[model samples]
Target chain A: MYVQRNRSLSIRSRRDPPANRHRFSISTFRGMQQPELSRKMGKMIKSENSAIGAYEAAGRERSSIAAQLSDWGESTDDDTVSDISDKLGVMLAEMGELEDVFAQNLEDYRGVLKQIRNMESSVQPSREQRQKVTDEISKLKYKDPTSARLETLEHELVRAEAQNLVAEAQLSNITRQKLKEAFDIHLAAVVERSEKQTIIARHARRLLTFIDDSPVVPGDARPAYDHETEARQVLEDAENDLRGWAPSVEPIPTSAGQESRVNGVEHDSDGLTTGLGSATGAGVSQPMTNGGPSAKKQLEEPQSQSQTEAEPIAY
Target chain B: MYVQRNRSLSIRSRRDPPANRHRFSISTFRGMQQPELSRKMGKMIKSENSAIGAYEAAGRERSSIAAQLSDWGESTDDDTVSDISDKLGVMLAEMGELEDVFAQNLEDYRGVLKQIRNMESSVQPSREQRQKVTDEISKLKYKDPTSARLETLEHELVRAEAQNLVAEAQLSNITRQKLKEAFDIHLAAVVERSEKQTIIARHARRLLTFIDDSPVVPGDARPAYDHETEARQVLEDAENDLRGWAPSVEPIPTSAGQESRVNGVEHDSDGLTTGLGSATGAGVSQPMTNGGPSAKKQLEEPQSQSQTEAEPIAY
Candidate 1:
């Protein structure tokens, strides 16, 4: 819409009460103090005040009548009351409209206050006064519209409005019930998800219980074998074997043959049996007295042993 | 307060010009003409209209004066204009009060309209009128105070009000700049979080790129023995091994050694080797007679050959 000029017709945001208000005169500023409008304003204020008082009296009467309807005695009946109820419904609508008018009127007057301020500060009697408000605004480090903080805040407001514009609009029309229904619906979804989670937890518990805690297989057969002990033995053997495989920081002579010479436990025959004598490998095929063609056969023969005594001799 | 019964004071919300108004006697309802409230309402209306007109005229005069100031030749000066500005400010405030009065007046008349409707339909001749609003409320399908929807709505409104009570209070004295500052602080937080997420993503990308593309293992020296691949291969192979070990849905014959006999694909020799006899048994110790005591030894010897020529006999 086309507006008057550089300024839109709106109130200047800061305003005090009317007791210190202006007289709307250019002649007074030019040395002629005009008091003509004062009488007019006074008369308006008086009439409006009376109108307000009368309006309030009327409202009190209506409310009083509504309160006393049940005491209307013999005249009160369903049909008559119903007919009046229709009119009451209309009155309620009018009441709502009246409330809106009050709010609108408040806004309009506030606008006028802002308008006066706008004219007071911006309408310069000379060219220099145009810069007055800008200078005043710049003095305020925080409230200045061009401040970095305000710029950042504007970005934030834009994002927030983008997200919650619907919510704000909804708020205007929102009755308590719509808000309840919306939240209750979400609550129900949460409850449903919780219920499913509870079912999942219940099933998991039942599944864990279904598996028996028993000593069964070291491969399903060696059930009689002490598999845990055997496993421990295998771990010990692997650890010892790994240590024998490489020198950590420097070149060192092989250790497996030394183990054989010292511990007398050489039984592996085909591979992983004896060392090649240096840091690297062309692995030696050591001989087994048990006559197994392969070292793996030799390893297996000892793994089946029931006692720890037989474990180190070959494994 | 006691009122003039059916003529309880008010201006009709849709009141026409003062030349025409109420026709309020009971016989008038049956079309007999009556004009009871013209005098009282007329005076109120006349005074209010005059006030409203005066307010507008003052505003127009101020606008006109501001427009004419530059042309006031040598007569206009800042101090003189400042004096008039003061007066304009007062007028602006008065205008605002006048707006409020208008709203109050409207409310008063709406109340009178309700009072008149109440007395006409429900009041007895010898007594004051009783309010029947609650009785009307109880009869409404949607408006009944006890309705579940209304209850839920009320609950929601209460919750919303409670949550927003701080916001409502803060807004009353809040300046635009203050609002901007508060929101700007929040925006900074959002920007910080976004920055953190960017850092997190950058670090994750760098970490993923750290490992070189080339393989670290020399698998040729250790054919059938990729330690890292063996780890992952062990995982894959173990999955396959387990599948081979268990019956899919029924109690069936064991399969490890059986695959060797049936598909002739015998290769692996872990503790998973089997005997297929009954409900349960000792694990299989099937003999390998292709000149290798250990199937693993046989498998490796063939894998080193790599030509795909010796695959069947060894594998």
Candidate 2:
């Protein structure tokens, strides 16, 4: 089958003259371009392949870590240090894998971008070629004398121009589609990889917490918290803030015909209010209109006083 | 104003005792019999709160790590030990927070389950009590004459039975609703947390990959591949399959007379073919009869093989 295909291709190539054979020559030129195109495509594919490989490797790393962690979870031993170390190692490995994939993807993106640039450069006409083509068309118009022949030539030119326009439009569309696909693929890969990182970070944080909460070896060289825990906490805090829960506050009362204001009076000159008398006497009656530092200070004074009084009661 | 509010609350408590008060007293009496129920609600609340806290903390940890890692990401420095250590520390801290929250939530869940059991025990009547009630009703029926007083007592009994039924149904409904709500909340939290974990894992993997690919310090530890990646890839592959991707053999040529045989062949292989291939080759002509594993495998094998070959050629 392969031999037959090659023979057919060779025969097809040699049967026609190079200049007169429009179909063969055009196709041959296209065929010749194929290898270069394939090479470029191959480079892109290779980069993508490597990126995917890195991605797979990273994924495997993460999965193994997950399995290990799960295994550790089921075990009865409290040798958290070893377990945590294993987890940390797994997390670190996973993180490294994620980074590898990310970097590879970036390289792939760059490769794609380079290919695009090359294609654009190759496709564009030089200034001299543009002028020559324009001049030739005009000269053809001047030389033609037979009205029918001129009309025919004009018709052919019009058709060619239309075809060229159509081809250009199609090419642009394809380019656009390819570009979009490339971008989308890159984005998807990045998102997927980033998401994995997030999981490792979370697990790592959990592991760290497990380690921290339990009593540590008296003179162990390990620090109080590991990198994973810190990273997890930071991410957690950011996420929490994003979800809107950094500070706790009582619901602001809203009532018709009553101006909403924070009540701030320091009758006791402390910062805390515990008993009903203090809460009602001045605190509830005096409403602070502003939320400036002075108001905050005033609020703090009463709270401090209240705290002093409350502390003794608590004791 | 606060004093007045307190006074009002006290008056209200005296007039129409707080539901919580009744609940508390009931809990105390039933504590020995149904200690679980008394603690369940509180435990559920506590668990929910802790889970939320853990989620928030994890988010924070991620953000902090992201910030720190961001710097490292841009740096071309080789000594990533310090950076790694720093990040590990953060992750550990975050993990600590997460574990604390998870532990709290787990405890709360246990408490809630205990409470549910307690409630179940409380709601059920002892066998002796049920017998006594049955006997009392029967006795009343026997003693009652065909008179106005007997009719009234019978009516009262009927009304009491109906009330009991309604109350029981309502209690069941309330319990069900509470359980559903608790489950939903817990499930949602679990899912959210799991997703976050996935994200962190993905990010961690990417980071790891990046580190692996990059020219970091020679002694710097390289991360390993884990199962998370495999699971994700498998999931993605399954999804793709669902979207539409499967292999099948071309059907055998059938003559007018052999149509019945063809139908039989289809019936036999119906179980082998999933929905994926059904949509694409719905009306295509077949060249073979029943497709066993070999035929199906033959058809399937080329796709992956061709894909592999085509990939390199494209690049």
Candidate 3:
């Protein structure tokens, strides 16, 4: 066998991109562009890989925080501290969801890649069949001194063409565009999910610091008011005043709202129960607010008030 | 065109993983176990894709925060607010670094995939050539296709075998294990980096809240006393006594460290101001220890004061 060891059924790419990748044509694969596409897609693959690792790490970090709460002597009987810890528990669960999403994102990415490999390999058998038919055609043309078989050779040519077409059809099965759609779609979702998750982590941090640095004792009888709630209301009222911005979700934290928020709050101020919300000072003054997205905007409390404010003061 | 339209070069997979994936036996390509492998690798690809999305999101989120800082009024002067704003700027820079790393990771992942596709495609030419040779040998068996032709056919079979060996060698160029190794290495690094970043975000949150909640006095000649500095040191010393741990880094925030922190502190306490360092307290504390890597451990403070303490007093 005079083996042509490197015959290929290659796809070509041009700068303009194929009009339709799945609809295979002679021009569909301009050359071999998977290398370039794969190289570009590599960033997506690596990013998802990072996310999986980060999600798992974040879960472990949150768990360590739970341990920290115990080590820091977070009085379990103190409703405020315990409340924050419970909310942290909820954030931890959200991290678990993020991990699952990350896993799915990875699967979808590799799934498309493996499909590409399989489709590319599909060319081998067709090329082999063509070679065999070509040889049969050649045999039919050869005479062993007397009998040449042109009919059989013509038949074999037909077979060869059929095999070639089969290979071409498989090439039509996928396009570069389709591969990106399959994989990159999930990537966008995961990215959005991750930023949301970081906010949850921020909430967890605020809750931890508030519980840790607070000097006020938990009220024995009366329900101690959390200034974060009142401040958020004031901010919402301010937002309505500033831009007529109606909050998409109600800003009020009902007792059930606090209990049921598995993913924590979109805003971090909900977790800050410290006098940071409403410090009355100098002349028992009020709060301060500057302009920005109220999500990150926080009001200033008078230092003189934060200084001598009653611990666990009612809003 | 009597095309066998749906003929497939499919790999057959039993539940038990086709013996070994790397052993390039003829049976290695049996029917095609691609669906199974694709199903498994899908997770990996999806994960990488998600990471890419998340890395971008994180970068964008950091940029938005920078915008928020500006919008919230980062004046050049106010030392306290501007100091926190400057630290936020450093964090934004770190986010940029993370985005770059994510891009590199994506490229590596896609590079491996493209290589795999290229290697798999290499099988086509050899298989086609072998088919042609086999047909030529068949033709040589005609009436006067004599012993001489048989000798030629025998030689051709040997060449076919050589081509088969080449195809097998091509198979060895890529293995499932190699793909995993190529893509998974960065995942570990990325994960560790993310958790470290969460801690960064935590510190950023604390600094922000500290600035936002404090009165906007640009320290007009009278030394500004931060109640938080006192409270945090007291907590640290309390923790030190509780764990019999000595402070590895000073908890007091020196303005010098702020001017100097290229990579922030190992412990948050080390970043606290010195004035809050030695607040005498009534100590009612007992120590607790737990076994773990203890990445954030502090060395012990003197235990003489922790035996009897008041609970929640102002500095």
Per-model TM against the reference: 0.16, 0.24, 0.30
The local lDDT score (0 to 100) that residue B141 gets in candidate 3 is 77
Interface RMSD of each: 43.7, 30.8, 27.6
The candidate maximizing lDDT is 3
**Rank by TM-score, descending?**
3, 2, 1
Q: Give the per-residue lDDT of model 3 (tens digit) for B169-259.
A: 3233232222323323333333434444433443333343333221122111323526456335433443344345221211211111111
Tens digits of per-residue lDDT for model 2, B1-315: 001111121223545466654544332443343233223333333333333343343334334433443242223122332233234334323433433443344334334333333333333342233345556667766776444555444444433333233223322323322232222233223333334333333333322221212111111233542434443454354334334522121111111121111111111111211111121122212332332212222222122222211111000
lDDT of 2 at B182: 29
Candidates arranged by lDDT, highest first: 3, 2, 1
lDDT for each of the candidates? 0.26, 0.34, 0.36
TM-score of 3: 0.30
- Candidate 3, residues A234-307, lDDT tens digits: the string is 33443344243221211111111111111111222112111111111122121212211221112222444344
lDDT of each residue in B152-264, candidate 1, tens digit only = 44333333332222221111112111212221222222222223222222222222111111111111111121233323333344335334532111111111121111112
- Output the number of the TM-score-best candidate: 3
Off by over 4 Å in 1: A1-93, A96-106, A109-113, A121-315, B1-315
